[model samples]
Target: MILLFGLFFILLIIGTSIANSMFISSIIYMIYYGLPLEMIPQRMAAGVDSFTLLAVIFFVLAGALMNRGGITTRIFTLAEKCVGHYTGGLAHANVLASIIFAGMSGSAIADTGGLGAIELKAMKDGGYDEDFSLAITGASSLIGPVIPPSVPLVLFGVTASQSVGDLFNAGIIPGILLGIIMMVVNYFICRKRNYGVSPKASLKEVLKCFIWAFWAIFLVVIIRGGIAFGVFTPTEAAVIAVAYAIILGLIYKAVKIKELPSVIKETLGTSVSVLYILSAATLFSWILTYEQIPQTIAGYLIGLTDNALLLLLIIMLILLFVGLFMDITPAIVILTPILLPAVSAVGIDLIWFGVIMILCLLVGLITPPVGMVLFVLSGISDVPIAKISRAIAPYLVASIGVILLIIFYVYLMTLNPSLPKLY
Candidate 1:
């Protein structure tokens, strides 16, 4: 047990990739235990064999197709028309655009890499502060994986063997709350900073943009409605999302059939990287389970407190700490098993817990050191990481507030039978 984690951390500190570090450490653990080396490949194969994981690939492809297909611009334009008139209106639009795009793409990286560029450019042209613009863009992208059709939620469902549909249903309110809180935070910050606001669009113009962006907006309804109504499985919804994206691209004349190969190539690269991390992390998690590490940890946590709310707070802290260093996929894959027993032991709802866990993990994307969203936005805006990190602090606080709010809501519901259920 000591060797497994010790080697893994050392490798991480020495700049090894998370996937490679887990893969190497697991192999070494197997060798040291005199376990069959053949088990490595078998475990990895088993990890990737999940049918639920297929949703990750299709969602990645759907996001890429929409990005390449120019669907994002229409969404952004509509967001601007609706919200660009208030103080810090462009900033509000930045958050709104992310909320809408979150329905289409389940990945934060995709949201950052796709809608982010358009948003940053628009804000810059609208004469918004660059730091504020970049910060909101990075922070808002976190919403992508919290909303329906979320890749992280899919990964969580598969890892914890929870229902993806239930997770999706549980996430809807919190995800919207995340955006609303960010916008509220933006309003105060912009007011204090005296940020510029755009002129209000005429009602006719707003309707025109909505009409133009109707197909783009409808993607959200299709995904959330399909899942909510049981019209399709999450995996099947992903396929429909891709097909819809392609058809919309053709209709908008924004993407050509010939352009699809490039989009697909990009999708393949992302999907392979995610699957590799999941596979390696699964094997690593399996070895930990073989050593009974998760059980030991869970027992220790349970010994500390039986109070469900307090236990959840401790779990959230641990998840936030892990998210600081690890990417979302492997973090979910590795920690879900280790932490889930403790979560279940406390009688917390798995679906709600899954949503909370993923949201906590998603915070890592905008944080320092390994924040993928930070890097994505920095590359897009040419802003320094330190600047982006500093700028994102207030919004970060807003995000944690949302998490706490949800936790308290669940806690209150636990105390009151009259309260509605999460799902």
Candidate 2:
């Protein structure tokens, strides 16, 4: 196993794509261990065979379609009209837009790539500091993976063998709390910097923006409401979301029919990238399970401390560190099997743990040295990664605080049977 991981990192250091690196390392491991070489293909195939994975594909498609369908502009307009009057109002609008966009697009890369461009432009044009604009854009993009229709949550559910709907439920409160906390942090920063604020929207203008954005807002309500009411599964919700996006595009005449092929092509590219990584990670995980890696790690951790809270904090630290170096999808796929057993041994609910794990990993997405969202924003805004990383420090602190709050909340809920059920 050490040899396999060594080769994997060596491949990564040499600039191999994550999917290829995992596949190649797994192949070498099988050859060394004299396992059936054919099992590699079998495991990879099995990785994407789940019915749950279908949701990921559809959601990726939905997000891509919505991005080109003119939803983001309306979302941004509505966010600005609603919150642009506050200090650092555009920053507040950035966070709010992310919260709204999060419901439509579950992928962080999508949020940063699609909306980051627009938000960064708005903030920069509004005379906000470039570093601050880029930093907040990247930070807010983390919300994409925390809210409902989240791709990471779906992957976590399948990888951990938990209910996707339940995981979605667990994310709702944490997602909103994280956004609110970031907004608070933005409020203070804006006040300190004396950032410019927009004129307050009139009742008429507010109503107009709201009416224009009503369909986009309804997307979230319908998806969440449908799942909560058992109107459809998450996978079905993705299909519904796609249909809804298409209908909106047609009705608004914003997304041209000629644009769909490219939209679909982009979606296919993204879905293929994710699915391939999943397939590779699935094979890698099989190797870990076959060697009882998760059990050994779980036993060692359990031996260190029997206190669930302490153990969870320790795990969060480790995941946070890992997130700094790895992308969230492969991290979730590879770590879920290893960490799930450890956390379950301490009597933590997998549903709540899923939210914690994902949120922590996502914070890494905004962290330095391979933070994907940071790179995305930097590319879009022409800002240096170093400056963006520095600017993101406070938001990172706020995000970590949100994670700690979730840990405590989940722990308290475990102890208090009177608390309302999250799902």
Candidate 3:
């Protein structure tokens, strides 16, 4: 175990990719144990050999298609029309837009990369400070993974063998709460900073904008409604999302038929990279399992405290720390196996725990060192990482607050089972 992790962290410090780091570390661990080398490919193959993972690919493609189809612009326009008149109106709109976009994209990087430019440009034009604009942009993107149709949730489902539908259901309230809390924080900050607001949109204009963006927004309705009503599984929702995106693109003339090949190629590249990480992490995870690492860790955790609430708090802190160094996908894949036993041992609901886990990890996206959202925004706006880090403090705290609220909610539900379960 020491040999494996030491080499992995050393490789990470030197800038080795996560996938390569895990693969190399696992191979060395196997050699040290005199395990047959052939098991490597076998374990990697088994890792991604899930029907559920198809949702990951299709969802990636759908998000790419929607971005290419100009759906993000419509979504932004609609949000602006709805909330562009209030103090810090554009900031509120930024959060609202991300919440809506989250339904379709389900990936934080996708939301940041897709909707971010539009939000920043609008805020800049509206006279918002550069640091504030960039801060909110990065922070709002975190909502993407917490909402339904989320890529991370899908990965969590496959990793923990939990129902993706229940996970989606579980996330609805928390995701919306995260957005609301961020917006509330934005309101106070913008008021103190005196950020300006635009003239309110007339009801006629708001209606027109909504009509224009309706199809794009309805994608979420289809995905969430379908899953909630059992009309289709999450995997099927991905396919429908792709088909709907293509159709919506054609209707808007935003995505030409010829442009699809490029979109597909982009999707393929992204999907393969994610799958590669999963495969390698699976091999690494398999080694841990073979050595009974999960059981040992679970035992130690239970020994420390069998109290469900306390164990969850410890798990949340560990996830937050891990998120500082690891990308969310590989982190979910590697840690879910090791941590689920500990979580289950404490009688915490796995479905609720999955949402809690994802929420905690999402904060890492805006945090320093490995905050991918921060890095994306910094590259786009040329803001210093230091400034971005400082600017994001309020929203980061808001996220943690929402997470704590959920934890307390779960604990309360445990005390009284009559409350509707998060699942």
Q: Which stretches of candidate 1 lie over 4 Å from their true place?
A: none
Candidate 2 CA-lDDT value: 0.90
Candidate 3 stretches greater than 4 Å from native: none
> What is the RMSD of candidate 1?
1.1
Please give the TM-score that candidate 2 achieves against the real structure: 0.98
lDDT of 2 by residue, 1-423 (tens): 789999999999999988899999999989988999989889999999999999999999888878877899899989999999999899999999999999887988888887887898899899999999988898998898899889999999999989999999888888889899999999999999998899999999999999989998899999999999999999999999999999898888988888888888988988899999999999999999999999999999999997878888999999999998888889999999998888888778889999999999999899888798888877776778899999999999999999998888777776775787566
lDDT of each: 0.91, 0.90, 0.92
Q: Measured by TM-score, how close is model 1 to the native structure?
A: 0.98
CA lDDT of 226 in candidate 3? 93
Q: Residue 141 of model 3: what lDDT?
A: 92
- In the range 1-423, model 1's lDDT, one tens digit per residue, is 889999999999999999999999999989998988988999899999998899999999999989988789999999999999998899999889988999999888889899888998888898778898889999999999998889999999999999999998888889899999999999999999887888899999999999999988899999889988989999999999999999999998999999999888988988899889988998999998988989999999999998889988988899889889999899999999999898888777788889989989999998998999999888877889999999999998999899998887776766675788767
lDDT of 3 by residue, 1-423 (tens): 999999999999999999999999999889988999999989999999999999999998998888888899999999999998998899999999999999988999889988999999999999999999999999999889989889999999999999999998898899999999988998999999998888999999999999999989999999989988999999999999999999999999999999999999999999999999999999999988998999999999999998888888888899999988899999999999999999877768889999999999889999989899999998998889899999999999889999899998887777677999855
